[model samples]
Target: MDGLYEQFRIALHQVWQRRWLAMAVAWCVAFAGWVAIALLPNSYEAKAKLFVAFDNMVPTAAAASQNPQNDIMRLKQTLTSNENLTRVVRRTDLNKLVTSDAALGGVVAGLRQRIAVVAQPDSLFEITATSSFAGLSNAENARTSAAIVQQLVELVTSGQLAGDPQRTQQSLTFLDEELRRREQQLQEAEQRRMEFEQRYMGMLPGTGTVADRMAAARTELAQLEQTIVAARSAVNAMRGQLAATPATVPIPGAENAYAGTASGQLAGLEVQLSQYLGRGFTEQHPDVISLRSQIARLGPQAAQERSRGSAAGNGIPNPSHVSLRAMMSEREAQLAAAESRRAQLQADLAQLGQRDSAQPGAAAEQARLTRDYDVLRQQYDRLLADREQLRLRSDMQTQASAMVVRVVEAPRAPSGPTSPNRPLFLTIVLVLAIGAGIAAAFLKGQLQTTFPTANRLASVTGLPVLGAVGEVVGRAERTRRRQRLVWLVGSGGALAASYAALMAAEMLQRGPVA
Candidate 1:
């Protein structure tokens, strides 16, 4: 512990002995550092916030614009593009430095790096511009930063400038031409379809192809056959019924009965029974069974009185038999009509078979042509719709200036430098200067052969050393030491005062920016 303390004391004494050289070194370092700091141009920042609503900018039918990520990215890229930056440069103080194309390119490149556009949630955007052009004054750089942000805002707000005018116009023209071509092609395709229908498919039933019509015809023939068989069975049943019915009714219960009647009422009763049967009534119907019973009851009576019939001596003609015969004839007529339909259907089937042999691929060709026509129609409609939307969009952009960006906060130049942190940098340089000075003095002490103490001297020499004598300061020597001390204090105070003055100047320099 004592050895460490003694070493520390020796270092302190050595540094004190070369204090003037240390002060001189510190002055040199501080001067260079402060001057370098002063040479750094101030970077002024300008910022603005915008509400970017995309709903009104693009049509809802535009599929690519469903997500806003692409739009935001495009906006960011466009704001920093070289053309916009060139315009910004021309409109600001940076225009003075752009003497040629190369100069403009350099300026634009630097400006692009300094500008930042960030998208926030809820369709918000923040645009920032930092200007630190070495060629311009600090205040001018601040003005240029604000101007840059303002120019970008203008670019975004201008409907015509939001997108390329020439490209939009070209797209509209191209779509118009394409739509016209599609219309012509559609007309030609429709004409071909009509001609095909008239020439090839005209003989087929309905609008179906040959095979479809043939299948439909066969199905109809099968159903018609069932109807014909049912009608034939009904006709046969009606024929049997008519043959079983007698053409006369016997006179009932009396001699000299009328020739046209059984007791002059048998024919009327028979007619009523036939009417019941014709109304789709069953044999189980009460009236029909009752009439049959009455007729059977009168049969014996009429046979007993047959010799006593009228002069005509013929039983009344049964209207029931006539009704049954008429029904049978009507059923036969219906069956004949059904047979005629069946023959016509068979002939159609034969004709379809022959057509199939003649043109085997007619159905497939028709289907393909119809499919192509439908697809073309759909595509043409889609193009027409898109062209209309594009035209409206273009008109809105040109005449109405529909695309709008609302500025929530307008861009303004900063009142102070955003970079360099002058106060902190000055402090750091001061500390570094003092540290360097102390290091220099310590290094000088280390290089010298002299030792500050007996212990240190012995340690290095490896021998016992005699005690050293203290130097006696006379009055003249003390006076000269005081003068040197004064000079050192003055130099140190001058450096400190320079730092304070620089700090004060930085504070005062903000007035112009504000």
Candidate 2:
């Protein structure tokens, strides 16, 4: 410890002997460092806070599970995107300053680097922008910083207000068009279903499984058979009533020599004679001659009796017999219709019974068509539902009921520059300059190849040093030493003047420290 102290003392004495050289080195290093620090541009940062709110107005289950932080992060990315940066540049004075398009890209990149985004809890965020300090005035730097931050806020807010709404409206229009297209498709599908049903008719698998369809067909067939039986019974009853009634009535002034005194007997014979005549019997033939003689004989007697105004009228037809004949005709027509219906029912039942025996290929094709129709129907329904949801979402967005962003704290002009701490820079420069000067002195001493102290000399020579010799001051040597001193002083003065001039020029061109 004593030896280290002694060595330190000796080195201090050597440094003191060359104090002028040490001072020159220190001054040079310090001035250079000071110039470098002074030339560094100052940077000013401005910050503002923003608050985002998630409205979740659409009332969807997914909305509850949605992460607001993800939205915030996405917004941050959008704010810093190249396109947004370009827009910001165009809106600000950057456009005028950067004339070349190629150079503008670099400027935008640098601007991006100067921006800082900090996400906070509760959907709060902070946006910061930094720029090189402008003019000498602190107000100018503050104004620049504030302007940048304000522009950023405007960009974000304007994008939210204008872009988001327009995008939502566009989406709504697209959805509306899609819904129309889907409706058209649904109509076409419905038409296809109708055609298919018409083509297959009772063969379709309607409302139930194959077994159920067969059961329904069988039940309908049985009902039709019962209806046919009832129709036949009604026809038979009408026929019996018609058989008991007379076919015709006696005509007035007709002869009665052909049969009994009953006018109906004479009417019946006349009807038979007419039938024979209608069968192509000539009037001169025996049958026709006999019928004609009979009619001529009965005509007078019947007319005389009719003129007597007898209580029993024989020329008029029986109303009951006429009614029974009409009923019989109606029953026959009904029986025909019922038989037709029964035949159709039988055919349908046969088809249902043979469904399993039908061609496998046809059955598979029918199933495929039915499945396709069902799928299309389901798809149409789903699209209809989605269209409604999209419409609701669009309305909510239009009303600004969804996610919202607002400036929580407006940006203000800074009171001072945030970067290029003048005092701190000067302190670092001083320390570095001192260190450089000390190193230079040691290097100069080493280049001399001579012992700087007695301790060093003793260690090198392995000898004991009794004393140190002092150089004799000759006249010429004294003059040379004086000249060297003057030169050193002049050089140091010139260096100081140069440094001061450079600093003054820099202050004039760039701004003074804010």
Candidate 3:
């Protein structure tokens, strides 16, 4: 370790001996760095700010229906699109200085990167722009910034308003179509109701609609009345026929029940005996015996009466027994005819009642259809109202839902160029050059590994140092040494080269002012 330390010290001393050369290289490199920075053109940066705010209208159900958030999102996308940027480029005439098309692309890209379009926290947007112009004035920078932000605002605003006409037109068209359809539906419904009324006219009572159960009942009553009328007519006609017909016409060979026969004489004798008994005659009295004898004598008469006649004239006519029998037969015939007619009328009435029972279902369906049409019509009307309100809003005098940009901090002409920070550049150059110079000197010394110190030579070769000697020279010896070009020439040339490099570095640092 000691040996290595001694070797390093010797190496450092050798580098010091050539210190001029190291200093020269460092100074040259640094000066070159300064000159490079000086020759490059200076650039200026300009920035501007834009403040944005969305519509602050009070939110109503109407506003919610419009979906204003969608509008805001669309505004964001429109502001960022290439078309808007291109418009900004044209308005700013950025192409004048940015000559080449490809170069212009790069400039535009750079502009986009530098510029910012950020929404402020809980507010609208903040737009910013930065540009580099070699020697632009304060006014010019301000104008550029203002122009860019303003153009961006216009681009976004125009885009926002772009779809208005088409949207409005489409709305109008839709409303018109809906109105027409609704009108048609209402008319058709009315026509259908009228047709239904006409078809069943008087079949349904008041309201002429079977929608009312009472009306249906009344209609049934009307049909029943017609049936009753027919029934009554048939009964009257049967009664008239029974009244006109003869009552006692014989039923031909069944004549034992007829008048003027021995059965009549015998029926008379029995009536007399019943009367005498009612007068309190005794069963064995003479009057009773005479009645009995008369009854006996009429026995043949009774048989004759049974065969062909009815008893007559014994103070009471025999009640026309044949006529009564014939009248009973006629009455039975009349009853049969009336009953058949009543059955037919009853059948017709049942059919009418069945029809009346089904009426309510049909009427209810029609009512449901009517209600649906009415509701749809109302919806269409409300939509129309909303559209009209929007149209009015567009026409009305009011502030636009847009932000105003203000220049909070105006740009100023810089006192010194922002670029080419001289001191910083110089420091960077000095540090790098010093590092390179030190490294080169150390590396050269290591690679050469010259035996500059007596100790180094002694240690490496194990040689003994006999004595350290300093040269003792006379004038002649010095002159002879100088005459030998090898040593003297090399030393002189090295010093001259070092001095020349220093002068050149100084000259390069301070060029012509212009």
Candidate with better TM-score, 1 vs 3: 1
lDDT of 3 at 255: 49
Where does candidate 1 stray beyond 4 Å? 56-65, 100-102, 160-404
C-alpha TM-scores of all predictions: 0.54, 0.47, 0.38
Global lDDT of model 2: 0.68
Residue 76's C-alpha lDDT in candidate 2?
Answer: 78
- lDDT (Cα atoms) of all candidates against the true structure: 0.80, 0.68, 0.57
Model 3 per-residue lDDT tens digits across residues 1-514: 9979987787677666565566667767766876786566543344334343445364555444334444455555556555566667777746455767776676677657756665554434555565454444433544555566666665554444344455557877887787778777777776776665554443434553344634455465566566656656665755544433322333445345443445544555566776777689988989889988987897776565434534322223324444545555665566566556556545544554576576646566556656766776687678778767766544331333443334444434333334555556656776776776666677777787577767767888898977677769999998886676455456546544644564465345434211
Estimate the overall C-alpha local distance difference test score of candidate 3.
Answer: 0.57
Candidate No. with top lDDT:
1
- Candidate 2 C-alpha lDDT tens digits along 1-514: 9988987876676665665777778788878888777777767788999988877655666343345776576677767877777877777555655769887898789889988889998889999988772333445555667777898888777654234455556777886777788778778776766675554455633454344565666676677688878988888877755644555454566434324553445456576776776688887899878877876787677666556744144356668788888888887887788778667767775775565466435445556667776877787788777766666545554463566679999998765567766656666766676667667776676666767667688899999999988779999999998898887678657755655565565445344433
Report the lDDT tens digits of candidate 1 across residue range 1-514. 9888987898899889999888988988999999999888899999999987654544445434234566577678767767778888888899999999998999899999999999999889999999999889988988989998998888888742433566668888999999899999899988988887876666545556556766777788999999999998998887757745665655464334464445445545656777788888899999889988987776666555555655236455668878887888889999999999999878767876787689888788878778879989999999998887777655654454333479999999888999988988999999899889989999999999887888878888899987889999999999999999999999999989999999999899988788
lDDT of 1: 0.80
Q: Which candidate is the best by TM-score?
A: 1
For model 3, the stretches where C-alpha displacement exceeds 4 angstroms are: 1-11, 39-41, 60-95, 98-110, 118-127, 133-407, 411-422, 464-467, 470-514
